[model samples]
Target: MFLPDVHAEPDTEVLFQFIKENPLGLLITGINSTSVDFLQCTHAPFVLDLPNAGDNTTPRLRAHVAKQNPQVKAMIETLDTKPSETITLDQEVLVLFNGRHDHYVTPKFYTETKPDTGKVVPTWNYSAVQIYGKLSLYYDSKTPETGAFLGKQMHDLSEQCERSVMGFTGDGDRPQPWKVSDAPERYVELLQRNVVGIEIEIRKVEGKFKMSQEMRPGDREGVVKGVSRALTQVGVTCMGIHLYVPRQ
Candidate 1:
């Protein structure tokens, strides 16, 4: 997470939006930092809950995994914790969101404008957000809160994804969004029972948008054009500010 001040997004609001836009985050965890022998990486949809004004609660991200997942088993074993009850891992983990915005820029895009006459090399333009935090698992509920957290997490995550799939701005061709309640209650409950809920107590969040802002104006435009052609996005919000480079 090497965040340059020039590309950092300090505004929590923008970062939150970015997370929402990219829910399929990569969860990376390991048994110990000393070796990569037991490293586990998973990509899953996560729901972020931001603290409200005056609220003392810190931000948290929630997701779920099948009970059979090796990563889940390894985490439980590493912490010597039972999966039947709520448990938190002492080791911190990382979650990364790429937001489906990335592109390759060739030298041809910058040769004309760069100061070094046609000396520019190929590079990548992309945006990424990283979350560092301790992870907690909610399995069979030992308490009311723990038991209900799984259901709520599933419901909220499903609703958000449904909205995204159905189009927030409203698409005439799309049907009504789906919900957890749409399925038979017994079936939904049965499926939920076979999975485990997870929550991350976010200790820090970092955003990096490398959209060629460091390039000269003309070279920058060349980069943006390539990005625009690839991603259809001319503007991207840096972690705190906005980078008006289009990654077509």
Candidate 2:
């Protein structure tokens, strides 16, 4: 969260795209100031309500998980407390979405650069986003409206998943792939009974892209090339933002 000006990502679109690409996130909240706990869940990308088209206001995140998950019980207990006059929801909760990262930048990549010439060193590069917000929790079957909302949320996520997987299939005589609707009434009932939905009303969003942006152009280019050729998983990490080289 301590993002320096050099690494700050002010572009909301870029931050949102990063979150969409990496949906699994950690939801963190506190029962009191000292009792902070984390809940991990996979989020479904939803439209973030913005006051204006270009506003930098934090965007809301939507996600759901099974009722059996311990996090659900912990959250419900936290919500039961009476609202305090001093601390509002805006100051309480935080969600973190981490993307692909690696540790392959070697000092050799920057040791022969122009600006530093012979004094530069190596550093790891990565991307991540942190969102601070209010939370709204919904349990299905608690009320008619909430039940319907849960059903709709599940249906929407199902469609999103299907689109991601089915779009690649070439035309053939094969039957359409399985959809959420294909499930029997009992299965739907079971899902409805077991699922809990969470809505995070974001107040602040912070993005960090530590992709050698601070290094001299020559040093950065060398790091990128070296990382690209490395056989470790870090190769893909460098390759992804290779085109997003630092601005002079």
Clashing pairs in 2: none
**lDDT per residue, candidate 1, 86-127, as tens digits?**
788888999999857566788777835654776677887778
Candidate 1 has a TM-score of 0.84
Candidate achieving the largest lDDT: 1
Q: lDDT tens string, model 2, 96-197?
A: 888765445888877447445567555777789988788776675556655776677777666555555345233475345456688897888777777766
Native-vs-model 1 lDDT?
0.78
Write down the lDDT that model 2 would get. Answer: 0.64
TM-score winner: 1
Candidate 1 runs further than 4 Å off: 32-37, 111-116, 141-143, 168-174, 229-248
